[model samples]
Target: MTESQFFTPHDLPARWRRKRAFTFVDTTFSAFLALWQRWHDDENRCDRLHVVALAHLPALDTPPPADDPSPLAAELARAWPMRVPGTQRLEFDAGRVVLTLAIGDDIETLLSRLWLRADAFHLDLTATADPRKLCKTLARFAGDDATVCAFTADKQQLERALQASGFACTPRDAYTDAPVTARFAPRWRVRRHEPPLPCEANAREAIVIGAGLAGCAVSSRLAGRGWRVTLIDRHALPARDASGNPAGVFHPIVWRDDSVAARLTRAGFLYALRRWHALESAHHDLQRTGAGLLQIADTSDDAKALAHAIARFAYPPAYVQPMTRDEASRMAGVDVERGGWFFPLGGAISPAAVCAAQLADASANITPRMNTDVTRIAHDGRVWRAFDASGAEIASAPVLVLASAHDAARLAGLHGEPTRSVRGQLSVLDPCALDALRLPVIGEGYAVPLGQDGVLIGATYDIDDADGEIRADGHRENIERVAGMLPALANTSPGIRAGRVAFRCVTSDRMPMIGQFADENAARLNARELSGAWPLDLPRMPGLYGAFAFGSRGLVWATLAAELIASQIEGEPWPVERELAESVDPARFLLRLLRHGEFCAA
Candidate 1:
């Protein structure tokens, strides 16, 4: 059956239309595309329409034909996702419409992993092996009054499955082949935790601490959703910490197996590219390179293995291609010793420019409070208030986000000191140095062409080292590392000692904390009862969130981190998968402590 026959525009309820955001789930691609087209064409649609499409097959290699008559199809085809496992969120209609493609081989497994309050469901009976299991999973995400419409030949089986899963199935009017419809009017509790709902805010205002990429990105996302943000920073301007670096490389990590970190990085890298494109479309100069970035393998054998893995995974050349030694040399414009995978879209970007552009995008809704250090934060059950070193209240809002890097844990009163400071020293080469370096290359170290600023290279990772000085030896270290990748740099010297030193915040697990903070006090009070509690089971501080500890991947992780935090605040469909989001949850450290019986309650 066609998608139009299973569901149509008339099926959308008035209540969902009035909401700030509504989520729609579809098991088939054609139906998802139809829903996307309907929402895109509707002039009086809700503030945001989130369409989650579950696919058991890989994404199409080619997009829709340019001559396709449907504008929606053409636009969606342009943003078609890569053939990667995990969720890929594509935004259209200037961010009003979001399509989350959940790609995997198992439909039930994919549905179970997703976390969203779906307002509507379009199921494909032929796609699922077991309709009962699929319906049970669907009940977990269904919102109040949620509606479901499906076309099935075995109507009795579908109706029984829907009824058993708590949906009140509507009887067909004497038609055996007609589509079945149902509403989420469950008689008993179907889920342990209630499905997500819009955050109850007294006002649409928030206080964002720090002004780096994390803070700026959060403020911009929240402001875009019509929130008034008071942006506070210790520096006189944004991106003055580690984000103050001249340039940073952006790319996704490809491992032999798709690890959690790899998936999270892929999501961040892709989302950052989309956001950067949007910013550039608005005339924002991100100082981004389009020539792509080259990563060198440790050895020739490892390079061959990675290339084999790339082919085995069938990664698109547009995303990443295995590069031969000669090809790597041609791309870098210099002779290289090793060959590795090349990210066609990966390159260097100015973090400060990105932060500036994000802040500029939300300028109308942001009130910048520069040179104000938030030493403490307090929540009074309703609003969160920030204070300065002088004990003066700096800003207060219904919602507060701590994006202050190393200072975030302290400000939020998190127990365990979940983050540590790492001092990194970067060296900037003269324009004449590394003249043959045409694009960014990373391995032991990284080198990027900064136009008139010359080649940007080197980042000495010194853990637990607080000494923030640009030393001559640090420049030597950077030169030697990059020289290993590009043999031409062997003759280069630390002639000018031109570099900058900044501190980076990182967790022991090397993952950034991105979501809402768990209420440590409350959790400790019931430590025994909560020891086995999941992330969602942990009590969260009202109106308080965090987006910090992004060590070196701030350029890539910051924007997606911001979107995740913003989605948490607005209760919108998450930009990443549920498991991926939990990996970066700020409460992860605290949850670990609780689980291990290591946390001591006060």
Candidate 2:
């Protein structure tokens, strides 16, 4: 049977889409022995063979009553090697030969799921006489190593199969039943067994699924708290999504009396500034431009409302000052018919630079697993397993956190997650057009800046659209918006334009979703009625957590969001208020559903 037959298209996972090979073949003890001998001869072989003794063979333990290998295989199948370090050794052939234990339960499944053309095949122990599993395993392992044979008494048959498969093979006979071993280490190894399992009273190793700004920040903070963490990302590099933007603005949008969004944004903004300052040495070309965001008042009503809101907050003019249309034009270096509010301390930061710095400075407690994508999440009674598409458990930890934008929803554990992907476009103008504009990070409909090389102008917000493709029409529309905002500079450069597009993950309420996935939903459901009877509100999957729904407010949430998540993992008081901390809870959708009859009704 083909690998496609093993899994339905819809049931297939993303990790499988990225697997290395997909072929299958049948094997017997004779084939296994012959292939093992070949790998032993080829010292430069890159493909390492792993053999997990399905069950201890008769000699090692007491022999079973039945000679049927199927029953024995079933018993051996019951015991799975959860996660083996990348450097384990198994002694076989009575210590005369040594084999590294590299293969496991899902080896065949995962191998077939890969998308690679060839895998350096070595003799593996996962095959059976059954042609179906054999074919599946062989197909998956049909890489550079596909030509290799396993230790088998039927050397003649093995030679024929190799030739048919276009492999040049030489087989050898074994003198004794020396328990041929194939215990090798994993490619991405971490010390196992030393730390207690989730079974350990206090789990030390935690797993984080996404390596975005939020996930990386959380991992760093948790590592600082002395917890060992594995930060995994589907992308080969960190901060490749919204965090990949060249530059991003940061500021707290304060409303009267400090609304939930305002208060949290304020806290998140300040925390981020402080965090960046602490990490400055590691980050390059970082500067506080001093230019604040100016919210343009479109009408008399908007102007009055801005003034009243500023006064209600009682903030110093430095943080929330009002400027007339004339002052706004001069400060912005552009003409504006309306007045606006300016935030002096507000500014922008190069996002990728910060993320790179954080990853570089990450502690020993944090191990970054790049290019590993997680497609399925399974809770096997004790520990939560993050598996790739091939159904191979890649990483297992007491705690699992999902920080990838909307990708968190892909996990069955987070299938009901409340996050939305939004499309946004930003533009850049030529040097001449930029020279006519100021270098401050301005806001309100459209903002302009003189970046390091040229003037940066933007942006178009489309909440319902999630396409990352750069749209010429969107860029043209944004240019028009900018022209209207500063009519005096309309003809500065008629055809000047260059732009980029990206997607933002948002929630219905506009606030970030940060906190234990379990409790947030419980609280949301009980907030109206079952308040007292809510479960411990802990995460459904003990170590599984998430940080998402950041929307366009990534800068505002990355810092405090990380702090809040790290605090929860450490069992400490949340950096922000309880209400604000739970405001962006991952399980808010679940709570909303319980409170409102329908989930999306909110």
Candidate 3:
């Protein structure tokens, strides 16, 4: 049935006057109905609604203390729809609407900060509710005719909060599990899913060149946007090269002093995690079960520095924590010698499974071009050509992305620039004794419990090693490094190492080179100083983009990088920091030099 059918008016006394902002105070079902009615009744505009998530959201059982040590309150305050922390102000839809979050045990601060006559007030007390506090705070903060939706499965608490805040909440169909008993609640079920986007525009077709994590993720997003995508990979399936690692670990690269790398990794990590959750539910098997990452301090001094960093930085609970060695061991299922900081959002995944799931989501259009190698790339003013085995053109698209790692740098047209390729070898151990150890993708070299096969150990970084052969020395080095971290893994009696070697592609600056392509001659000539060029127009290399030089931060950085590249091609707002985008621009460094009369092409 349509949403309009759900609206129900409140039953208030004649003397009690209700404002438009505070009008809908019926039962829980009515509160939802009012929200639905309001959303549907309003004109379809791109106006962002200011939201204030009032009330503490707790973990499973215990209620959050009145003054909790965690930063959840601060995070919620900063991330609230309207608020951007440290700015004391809220900008909605670029300042069309403003918001101020009221956070305090005192009722005055809560009332004063909650200024907006809210279109909807999300009163989530699913954690634990103090009715007296809820009533005192919301009663003063309630705007005229504003609709407030309060939640609590506890009948008494629900009634108490509703009566105090002048809200009348009736139960709606709860299709979700009850908060206390996560098992299915019989009366109502809440099927949590992404709300359907308003159907306004028709979908367009997209072609993504690589089927690695980046390509796979972007393809999934495009599909989510109702766009048909053709994901082409040289490999028959996905993750054939560096992406072929059996257990692809996921973690945000947190740095010291909230550096550029740390900030970028944080945003990218959050985006990736959200996208993973939004993907079709059937793909859960691909995601390995584990807590977030536990990043051990590189050194003791660094550990002290990290404690300070965690305090200063705005870290979400999902990804930041400083724990003692004892605490770290408890968090991770094993013994950690050094005290470590953990990213609660970090975990490992089966790379193959993620790729397969993305392809499956776009099964109708993501055509896999297996064993079909593209010898060279030639941009013919309009479209780029992809050649086959016998020098015959296979497929030509207006947009061509070179995501083939080191292979893309070797293509003749790009004038062999130095794209470093190194051989990385990893060993997978049997899960016999290692199963008991709690390995959570540790720092330096890690020992991860691979499903059934064993724990994955050792990843030797061999730079300038062109041959992607599994070197015994490299394997031994990895083993030694891992042994140093875990200590217990030194004994080879129970843990046998099975090596898998892959080549990593890197660039001079270590950033993944993305964006439009330039002629080899032009790039070489203008390679000294390049910056400040919008929609760069030199040689007409249309529909040519490069997504390579990822180094070893592939899993951590690829997905967001892919989206940024795609957005550049589509002329959409870049999905990353402007400086980062500039840093990765294919011709940014080269173009600046030519503009400054420093042409040095050999």
Candidate 4:
């Protein structure tokens, strides 16, 4: 069920021809996992699979039944680690098998919020509410030539319900679990959503600007996909911006309601862990801190609220759990002041090292064209050519990626988009402060134990500040904030006067701007025609993309944003839902204007 067996060349329905198939399952998921394991073992099959399970309410507290080494229920129990509310994606077989389990939430609730096309559906009658209702839910997402396999004792009645919901019934005598199945041939035509049309040619050459975290990530993904990359940068080396920080912490932002930002951050954080692990196995020097991070909720109320959220979501102790002040003290080796939730996976890494590793890994397919400041980008009907200050062509390719932080929009001729520059200064203190500071803790600010570099602190978010020179005031603010939180770091201040300064590019919503840059002038001229347009409907500049506006979350946002761009370019099933993808869409501003009836008038 998790594999692409249902939608292959011979078995594929007409509507989903030549595309990766999305299969929906409504059941206990033990059967689905068995099918997934089978699909993973096959060597000849390569069809991509996206399996979404609108699970029937599970026995949330029930432990796995006593069994031997290999049982269907036991296998599922081991695989389905996060059984909390909302969506939890479990990837196996190296991303070939994606099982999205929507725990505690029903299929209809998820359908209302998500955008997906299900070409195949398997409904276990014992698991679903009503056969008719389940059929209706399938009709909403099923493609024109859909197929539904229903396992039920009352085959005749189930067939009638499916037929009423627009599927033509077929009852077979010799069937395994599902005695009856239905192939869709609706009498009434349904309005189906068409995906964004891929460009005429699947271009394999790309020119990426900026060699920072975002740029290196994009370049590496493209190179892995066999795309020849020309990595360009104005600076002599990469990671010279905010990514130049000695060490920055990585953790998902948690919210009571699990806001879009929080959800995306969780996805990003998980993907980054997978990516970092692979990088380290390949011998990349990440210099990561795997001892976990403690997000100190210094105030009693803050701690209580955080604890409530940790239990509310049923987040596993392995992922995140609340700890007492005493427990935290022991974990940090020497800490006293705050109790908070600890993310066992959250840790810090040198950004420059990660960037260098990505470039080195992609060295075979990536060509460096450094010290080339791209002043302007021009698309001559086919290829996008970048020009230097003296009007010399730096590099040109069919695809152009702008990952140059604040300069991303300017280089792509999208200066109208809002991107604020904030000056940040990080103070590096001597090893004297290292006595009690064990891990990174965020309160008024962050306190990072930078090992040999000593304790790194201070980052004043000075908005609209373009000056990149380090300041004593920034260092003073950093030291005061950390001392206020840890107290033990108070004496480490005099040595913290030395630090580094970098400007960060952040968006109003605090989400990174990703995806294709919309042709705003074209959108303005044809505003009336696109008045109620969605993101995919917006006219975009072909071959021009962005992965900037990461703000202070480059570590968390890097791999996911890179994967999103790669998926879009390859026309693969998106790693994110449509709503999540739209939340970070570069065309969001243009769509906002059109929605408010301002684009046409402007």
Model 2: per-residue Cα lDDT over 1-602, one tens digit each: 22332222112222123332122122221222333344345544322232322211222233222453543233323322212111122323322222222222344443332222222233434343332343333443343333333544444554444444334444334555322212112233222111111122147778887777888788877775566888889888888877877677777775545677876776677567656755774454454456677666666567667788777645566557877778887887767757777877677777777776666666678888899988888767677788888988888877777787787866734545466777888877665543656645354445556455565656677877857788878767766666665665466544445678878888778877686666444444445453322222433445666787788778768867876676566443235544565567666566545545442211
Model 1, span 44-98: residue lDDT tens:
6688888888886554556666787887887887777877677788888878888
Model 1 vs. true fold: TM: 0.96
Ranking the candidates on lDDT from highest down gives 1, 4, 2, 3
What tens digits encode model 4's per-residue C-alpha lDDT throughout 1-602? Answer: 43343333215333333444445454455445545655555554445556766654454455455563556447456654444455555655555556766556565565444445566666657544557766665665666566776667677777877888778876566545534677778797533454333344456899999899999999988887677999999888988888888888899876667888888888788778767876897899998987889877758678788889888877778778897888877887666477877888898898999999989988999999888798999998899999999999888898899999989878776635678898998888876654566777776788787767677887899999877788888888887887766767676545752688888898888888888889888899888878899887888898888999999899999888987787677654456667888999988877887887786635
lDDT against the true structure, each candidate: 0.86, 0.56, 0.55, 0.74
Task: Give each model a TM-score.
Answer: 0.96, 0.61, 0.65, 0.85
TM-score pick, better of 1 and 2: 1
lDDT of 1 at 390: 87
Where is model 3 more than 4 Å wrong at Cα? 1-207, 222-230, 280-284, 431-433, 491-497, 519-540, 592-602
Ranking by TM-score: 1, 4, 3, 2
lDDT of 2: 0.56
In model 2, which regions exceed 4 Å deviation?
1-201, 281-288, 415-417, 448-452, 464-466, 489-497, 519-540, 597-602
User: Who wins the lDDT comparison?
Assistant: 1
RMSD from true fold, candidate 4:
4.2
Error of 4 at 320 (Å): 1.6
Q: Which candidate is the best by TM-score?
A: 1
Model 4, C-alpha of 441: deviation from truth (Å): 1.6
